[model samples]
Target: MIQKDSAMKLPVLFLGHGSPMNAVRDTPYSRNWRRLGQALRQRYGGEIRAVLAVSAHWCTDGTAVTAMPKPRTIHDFGGFPQELFDVRYPAPGSPELAAEIRSLLGGHAVAADFGWGLDHGTWGVLCHVFPEADIPVVQLSLNVNLDAPAHFALARRLAPLREQGVLIVGSGDIVHNLRLMDRRAPDEAGSAYEWAESARSLVNGWLENGDTQALTDEAAYPPALHLAAPTPEHWWPLLYAAGAAGADEPLQIFNDDIVGKSLSMTSVVFGHDALFEAV
Candidate 1:
């Protein structure tokens, strides 16, 4: 087996996949995800066993990890084109990894289920990263009700998985205030863009520091964060990824930008050496 630090570590990603359009358009964000996926594969093609995605959409009462051996594509959103609905990511599911995830969380905190499949949050980005849909995947549900601290702790617990070649992904938008999601309001776009950019810069700092405390505490963030995240579900994944960073680990921004008023689709990658060096 490869030594933990010596072998390239699998980096964690925080993808700000804005609109459902990402599932279809070959825009910069989609292209970036694709390029990142290809680069990751080229670096660790045969060694990567599975991908564990923590999507913003599958928020439940408690932490649940999908254990199914063959997970399917779930069209979780509506009002999309038939072509978008038809898009599929056929990444296999890993039972062994599921068991390991359960084991990683210990007995009480983590639960397992067999049927849940990939939601738009997972496939929206993965469709680009692993377009071939060849790698096995496991979807881990977010405890929507859980606070940032809880999510951060959970991420720390999951840190070891990177050594084993599991790419942990956090899927959500940064400035996701649906009330202002106007595709046409120019004023709304400018304000939301400003907020998203500010928030992204602050978040980038925290990630680079691997500051678990700052990530968990709401007050530590800018005032805009409250507006960006009226709920904790979307931002919690970032805490998880950051907590998984240990200390002083380098964080890289894979994609960053604000789209529309309520959608900040800027995404990030943590563990610079782990990912870039290998690439």
Candidate 2:
């Protein structure tokens, strides 16, 4: 076995992917993501081994990872512009890494799932993060049957990959509730509900303070649990990113804003900021 080196450790990211349109549009959110990609190139001297993404859109019966090379770009969402659907990330996949992930999650139930490829949630963030699609990418599915704590536990198994130069990303909205959203005025930060702001604030605090248990406990936060999420898919990815973080690692929040009445644009970063600081 080749020993992992400390210099190769990559950072973990949890992006609040609001709209699929953001993939095609050159918005502030997309620009920020591009900056991170640029920073990665500068830091690792233009070589990021691979990316492992856990997206909200690819929920499965059990945890799984995409293991196919040249995996398909899935247009999972509908009613988007033709250009959005036409766009392709074209990032390669690593079966080796996927198998490694399966081995790591042997404590849990995880398999190599060849059926599902990269979805809107994964590609939308990566399009901006790695526009050239030069590096390999893999998508991990969220287990639909698991609760928040279980999701976090499964994600913790992936923490070792960071040391092997895999960028672990959890893509989902921190505060996502389309049912209560003001559809007419989507992406409105000023009109964000007070309760939504409070909800994200609590989560932000939990991430910053490294309070993983409190963050996962649904009963502790009834309002945010019931209202901010409504459904747990979008909210669950945060736990994945948080679980990958070291116990006392400091967190940095970026693109911090609420959009579309209920969706939050808040993104978080954990570890390996050498290039980020220079940028």
Candidate 3:
């Protein structure tokens, strides 16, 4: 069983980072992220030792962790404005933390990755969250070979880091279907396709009720799963955040809106109620 230390335990975040533009644009989503960061600093002060990020964009045949001391800001997507590409989050990387993470998930044979740096899924949201980029950040890659249950099981091993002041963050959209996106649609709640809204609601219900099993089980998914996800990479990061959280921890939902007619910006936090107040 994963042990919990209430006093020192940090919260787990699953942020739905929709577009690379959000990193530079001053939208409500980015504003909330900035507020969330301020709230974290206000509450935890310098106790936030490091960040362990699991991003949808970083997927590998097997699990891996970024080990480079000075990781570069990666611009993985194309067609974005030059301003977005120019944006850099110069966060320091922590090899010690990466090694510790590999040690924690020793069963998975997690590799030390020096090549892959912080992709948009990690840096895009983090550039707003911890704007200063002073904290050491280490990214864990999503193993495409593993199923949702397997990913969750692997993430459970890292729960102990919470007590050590590690902020575990999973960056991905709850419902992401790029092909069906309607760019003209307003970015707000209830503006998505019916299937997308249904899918988001179903997942939110499971999260709110603490039904982690339903989330991982394919049979429990709605019929719109194909339209909602299209591919599992984006949805899989949520499992990591849910798995690392204490079973009984209170969950707070934020930025629960859908944009582009196919992307859901529903974010959740396990523990740290003050953050909800901040945003």
Candidate number achieving the greatest lDDT relative to the actual structure: 3
Q: How accurate is candidate 1 locally (lDDT)?
A: 0.76
Question: How does each model score on TM-score?
Answer: 0.90, 0.94, 0.95
For model 1, give the RMSD to the true fold. Answer: 3.2
Whose TM-score is higher: candidate 2's or candidate 3's? Answer: 3
Each model's Cα RMSD: 3.2, 2.0, 2.6
Per residue, candidate 2 scores C-alpha lDDT tens digits across 86-164 of: 9998999999888888888887878888888899899999998898888889988889999888888888888988888
Show where candidate 3 strays beyond 4 Å: 1-7, 186-189
Clashing residue pairs found in predicted model 1: none
- Whole-structure CA lDDT of model 2: 0.84
Ranking by lDDT: 3, 2, 1
Rank list by TM-score: 3, 2, 1
lDDT of 1 by residue, 1-279 (tens): 223443667778888877777889877778878878877888778767678898888888888888887888999888878999898888888888888888888854777777688999899989988888888889889876667777787788888889887888888876677775665752232355566567767766766666667767876767877778877777776676677776676766755556666667667777664454211
Q: Give me the runs in candidate 1 sitting further than 4 Å from their true place.
A: 1-6, 185-193, 273-279
Clashing pairs in 3: none
